[model samples]
Target: MPLNKKLAEKLNKRFAPDSRLDDTYQGLDLTYITNELGEPITLFIGKRRPDGAITGERYVRTIKRVPNSDQIASSHWDLKGKVSRS
Candidate 1:
């Protein structure tokens, strides 16, 4: 399923305060945060880990960010996706 507009908007507001995503764009498997001039800032990718005690698994990722732009780029391994700002 695609991400709801309201939820996406909220995330965009939280992550990319200076810019807004297009309404037509659906759920994002990956998201990148770029500077106003379109420079890469950070990279985040998702991962899944097995939990022996739990019925299901947990998802997480290691994020890398650049101090200069304070932006972020994220990818989802489970979803097999990647997003880059520049």
Candidate 2:
């Protein structure tokens, strides 16, 4: 499901400085680490294959937060290529 605006806001506030989200799959997992604004953050975790190879490991993309309705509307448009798509 799509994340709600209120929930997004809450997450933003909760993870503002030193909090994050974690997800797991089998023996693999991902952690969204915190970082300074405009700086790149790293994601760590994933499973190794039978041959000791790893897959599905990746970094979480940094997204600049929009703190106002106008920015949020613009972001929505950018994401969907139009405001009415959602």
Candidate 3:
């Protein structure tokens, strides 16, 4: 065995978006929007929970400019981050 994953290596799958937006836990909302200068910025809008096992919810979005239309797309639970449950 080569002890390596060729598919992962080929695609450079080093990181993936978060997937923890289930209904079991109440979570904060996320917004990816263009700033005043037309630059994209990611924002997490909410207070962190103080509980040990409390998890937060969020979404990721990007502003794409189509030929004749500007589309704002989003994917829920796409924020990759770690929370210390301690």
| Candidate 3 clashing pairs, residues 3+ apart or interchain | 27-57
Write one digit per residue (lDDT tens) for candidate 2, span 1-86: 23346523333432444545564544554455565432224444455445433354444433545675313222221111111111
Lowest lDDT sum, 10 consecutive residues, model 3, at: 7-16
Question: All candidates' lDDT scores?
Answer: 0.33, 0.39, 0.33
lDDT of 1 by residue, 24-80 (tens): 123323333444544322223222123212112122323345666555564221222
Report the C-alpha displacement of residue 68, candidate 3, in angstroms: 4.6
State residue 68's C-alpha deviation in candidate 1, in Å: 2.6
Off by over 4 Å in 2: 1-13, 19-23, 36-40, 48-56, 67-86
Question: How far is each candidate from the true structure, as Cα RMSD in Å?
Answer: 12.6, 10.6, 12.6
Q: Least lDDT summed over 10 consecutive residues: which range in candidate 1?
A: 48-57
RMSD of 1: 12.6
- Which whole-number lDDT from 0 to 100 does residue 44 have in model 2? 42
Q: Estimate each model's TM-score.
A: 0.22, 0.30, 0.25
| Candidates by lDDT, descending order | 2, 1, 3
Mark the regions of model 1 whose C-alpha exceeds 4 Å error after superposition.
Answer: 1-54, 74-86
Superposed model 3: Cα runs more than 4 Å off: 1-34, 37-41, 45-59, 68-77, 83-86
